[model samples]
Target: MKKPTLRLRLLRSFLVILTPLVLFLYYENYYAIKIVREEVSQSTSNVLSIHITQIDRTLDEITHYLLQQIVTSDTKSAYLDMASLPETNGNYTLAKIKIHNELTSGSTAFENFHSFFAYSVKKEDFIFSRSSFTDTNDLKEMLGEYVREKVKGQSFSDWIVLRYWEKSYLVRVAQASDGVYIGAVLLLEDLIRPLRGLDYGDRWEAILLDTTGQPLTKSVMSPETMTAVNRKLVTNPLAFQVFENPADHKDYLLVSTDFKQAPLRLAAMIPEKSLLQRLPFFQGVIYLIPLGVIVIFIFYSHYLRKMLFSPMNSLIMGMRRVVKGDMEIGLKEAETEELNFLITTFNHMVSQISHLKINVYEEMLKAQQSEFKHLQAQINPHFYLNSLNIINSLSTLGENDLIKKMTEHLADYFRFITRSHRDTITIDEEVRHIRNYLEIQMLRFPEKITYNIDLPEPFSRTMILPLMIQPFVENAVIHGMEEGSKPFHIEISAGNCQEDPNCLEILIRDNGVGFTPEVLSTFNQKKFGDGTGTHMGIWNVYRRMRMAFGYQAEVTFLLGEPNGAIVRLTIPAIGAFHEMEEEEDGKADDR
Candidate 1:
């Protein structure tokens, strides 16, 4: 399976974290709404109870006033006089006038009472105050109708709420004497006046309803809401209830309380929306909930991207570059300590790798240069002995000119060899030294040894390790002479390598015996030590070339045609002038 991208991984991680958080927020919001609703219901119920208490107190006052009127000495005396009087007597008229005066005075003291009346069964007459708002006949007719409908079978002093004309009234019927009935009319509005002081908001309404669920006073609720409430009250007529309005589908909280002194239920209806609006804190929580979630998500994404994803992506890219051999690339500092530590460690590792590469290259160059110097030192003694033998033979021949010239060449060759401090020399210098050694050999065997040196001017100034090519030339001369019957002819040539312009190619060919199969196999295997001294010069040269220039230099020994040994070598064409300049700078630095 393919690995997920960084963006996909981050998204997955965010989802894994966000899913549970969203669920938690949802549950928290649900619980908060529930709690708010419960609190609203409870608060609304308390308000309702306050209004009910006020209504109850007002009714109690009204009841007290009516009771006071009933037991008063004036009212009792009026009832007794009306009972004792004859129908045609003038005292009966005076007694009825006194009763009327007493009822009028009592009604005047109470602001709620619209009127007062007394009925005498013995006189078969209705007596009431002339100060009453309605005609005496109308009042008597309303009282008679109210008694027949709601008060006939009820006990004396029972209060009934009834409508007279188009207005509602609270009336209590009482037996003032053995045959007398007294009733007082109090307006329903007067009973409900205490509720008017309440501060229910615009979306809330308070209403007075009778035991039959009939509204006794005007209500702010729409007709549809009232209908729903009435229907709900039939089955679940709780003191407090919350239900949705069928007409608008808005929730409403209802709180109801019964008046102890009256057959009325006081109910407060408030929209659930209004209750929530009333609490500014709750409204803020509701509005801020979604905003808070969005804000949290935004901040969290940015934090993860900046502190986690971005740094990790950079580190991964840096590692990829490192794998591709780009040690120069580096990661920037990170904000978090852990990431910073990783960046620091990676940078240090790259630095160490770069340093280690340089150290290894330098060490290899030193080892190769040391080996070349040691091998060159060993070859010097053998060449010196051969040159001495050739000079001794030349002296014995008594050819003065030849002896003087050969002596001069031998001195030059030895002088070049003794300059052990010089690890490298120009191609021109090496060629001159090789020519000097070959000339000495030619003097020893004048006709048997012949040579040609074909070095171009362009390659003359190229620098190489001293004795690198001379060893191969010496080897060709020594090994080829063993099998050749004809005069040994050596050809030395130099040119720029065709494949690599920076490298110089040198070819040495001699008409003589070539390398044996075992020697060639050892060279191919790059095994330097062959135990025999004959292969040492070639092996040393090959090893030095490999170590000093590495893969840049190439050396091969092969048989030329059918009768000669051939040696070819290539080395980097480092200019002598540049090397000399570097040496001068090094010396200046040392000084």
Candidate 2:
């Protein structure tokens, strides 16, 4: 069996010995920290809870006072056509003033108070203000419509905002009897001040968020933390939740409680750092106990080094040699039984690897030789056919245009065969070469074929494997259309495929004798059937496609209806074709 790795052996030894010792230390530290954090959290939660509850009670009292004042105030009837009152009306108003004074003074939990305008179906307008000469009508009109909406049936809503003097207030509406509405604002900062005063010197902070989860106010370390807390509350709105910063992985705890009498959300945030601060100083001593473990590790490491590390070094060196192609080398022998067995297995592995290399090399050589022979056979036949046409053209050409076109075709064909430096050419250059070949053939069989090339203007700069379309054209001429007075019309159009924007599609269509069902099947199979003659051009083009682009870029031959054949080739055009086309264009321009 193979020997265990050095890391595994070290880990096993550590787990058997050091793990329990370290684990005990970890548990002690973890639990101790956890206990302190929980205690601080629970204590702060309780104190903050009590203070917030009192604030809620105070807000309820404010609502009750508003309700009582609107009900008792008889200014509406006294201003009417018939005005009368009991004789003790002055004392009654004085007593009402006393009660208002007591409620305002008792509301030390709030920064300021203002009663919103009361609108009633029975009473036309009822407004009050503490300022003697203040115009309460404009503010009352603003509250009037909202009061009407609230009394009509919609629940009154609350909003909180931090105002002057670093105080935050919750402003909301409440309904009294008989279609009357009162809007009051309560300050939570004063309420939370008592909770802050109960801090036990642990760097803790207390904050309050109204039920809407907007940050009413905070005493955290930074404003960024406050923003993060607000964002978290809005994202995940569970009442009591703890979240960690997704970017930094720091934990933050949030606890929210509902006020029984008001539509208020009281949320408190305590950061993980604040919780960790509550641990006692004595726990630091317990964490430092692991320092004594150094002596035991040193004695143990010395004995394991000779037995484990030395054998591991030999194994590592042997692996490096194998990776670097010296597969015959094997590990050195060691006295340890595990190391002995490892070396023996390594020798067997080396032998198997050496045999594998020979087999792979032999198979590759066979493939390469076959490819070479196939290339040789394919190139010669194409050359012979083109050379025969050129010779025939030279022998019988009369006009200057005919000779010039023939020479261009002959030159282009030879240039393509001789150009060994590049396997690809620009789409414009490929089209030009095809034009030259067609121009030459047009002279010999002037009435045999007519062809048109259609490609997007921008795509003329894209690249394609050279001679990709040439062979297909040659096949259409030779196999599909032999001769006619009305020449076979061939149209070649290139564009981006509709489905895949990254791919380019080339369609070569010819009005000629289409393929039989058998021929179509043979083309699809891409093989010779029953020893019948095969077009070397089509086969060679297919082989080149497989070699260059694997299976993604392929050529398909389809027999069109009546008397036509369509050859479509789709190739990746975004990066591969565009870059190569530009490079080829640069080279051509330089030439």
Candidate 3:
């Protein structure tokens, strides 16, 4: 496993020591709050139960009177009896008036009732009723089918909360024989209105729900409280739940109870803040313990930042500066022991890096010098004697002009070979040396050799490996020429390579016999030579380029269009690397 940094280790240690105290205080506070919420919730739920019971008793009383008057009397309701008789009967109108008066008189005793009605199953209409708000025709339109379904000899139904004519009511009905229904309906709001007077705390609300968990009354509920009550009612409808309101952003205790005589649920919502307001005075002192821990934790964090992290930041910045090649930066001495050790180690590392950079640069310069001297050694002494023989043959032919030309070519060739060794020289000097050697070949083979040199003006002074192109040209002349009726042609061309604006391309092509398939395969695989000294010049050139500019040296051998060999070389531009080196050296000088 990787070891942790000093900052990470220190932070973890601090948290390990601090966490248990925080959790203990938090648990104590949580335990006390839980105890207080339970007590307040129990008290509030009992009070809500009593309120539900009061509503049930009031409904039960109204239903009891209706049941007795309609079903248990010695006579069925007079209006119900008259509904079964003919409309032409003499007592029909009188019975209607008489029974309506009785219903109105009975309804006055229960002032909470919105209405009372007796339905006539035979007539399919209400024959006795007490409601001034809605006329008999409107009542028949609303409750006509409801009355018929309820009075089919069933005794009664539990009070069901219903919405009628845009108003919610608590409706209870009792069947009086097969032809009559005596039912009482009181507005549901009137039944729950007493809840507003009861106190849990300010902004408390109550909602009336049916057994299916649908709210029948939203009057006392704020939209936020009603939403919370409904969501809690889904999971557990008969007990208490706590929920947070999104709109008001406060916790509320929801108290609910099932009704025995009514098909409804009574739920009340009181603020959790109010419930906690009833906590004992000692709880505040308990709260201060956790609060004090938070204050200490914050103070410790600030102290750690100043003592440890601030110094660590300075070390990190110094490391970044070195990575970007600024080797002159050093961190200040830190106050802590661990940080001081790290800073001293860091400063030592940077010093070692500076020394290593100088060593590598010196080694590269020595390598370049050794490769140039190696190229000078590659010149064959036999070739010098061959040039002398060529000059002797010219003299034997009694051609003074050709002899003078051959002597000058031989002079130039040997002069270039014996000159002082340089790591780099101009493209102009290298090209001049190549031209002089090719001219000596033309002098020797006047009719058989012809050459073209296209050296553009722009790259003449571009610094490149000394004698870089000469070896390849020498190889072409020695290995590529064949005895032919057609004149052998050698073409040397130079231009910019696309990889960099300063990168140069040199193409040396010859109309001579190309390599056999086996030799081409060896070149293609980059196995430049066998164990013997075959293709030594090509091998030497390729290795020297790699040593200097790395992979930017590209040498490719291809078969020409009909029968010649083509050597194409792409080498890196050296100007940019040297310019960067110069800048680095100048920075070192200033430091």
* CA lDDT of every candidate: 0.75, 0.65, 0.75
lDDT of 3 by residue, 1-591 (tens): 998887788878878988887777778778877877888788888788887787677777887787777664533647455656666776766666666777777778764556777776677757545556454566666667666565555445677666667566777777665566667777777777788678678877787787766778766556665666677778666578787767687788878887788887887778888777767553775768768777887888798888888888999989899989899987899888999999999999999999998899899888877765665466435356656777788788787888887788777766755653345666787888778778877876778888898888877766677667888787788888898668889999889876677677989999999888988878877897632387666777787777777887888889998889988888876567456546545665776
lDDT of 1: 0.75
lDDT of 1 at 515: 76
What residue pairs clash in candidate 1, if any at all?
none
Q: Residues 356-414, candidate 1: write the lDDT tens digits.
A: 97899899878866777776676667667766777788789886777788879877777
Alpha carbon lDDT at 410, candidate 2: 75
Which prediction has more favorable TM-score, 1 or 3?
3
What CA RMSD would you report for each candidate? 13.1, 25.6, 12.1
> Could you tell which candidate, 2 or 3, scores higher by lDDT?
3
Which pairs clash in the backbone of model 3?
none
Q: Compute the lDDT of residue 534 as modeled in candidate 1.
A: 60
TM-score of every candidate relative to the true structure: 0.49, 0.38, 0.56
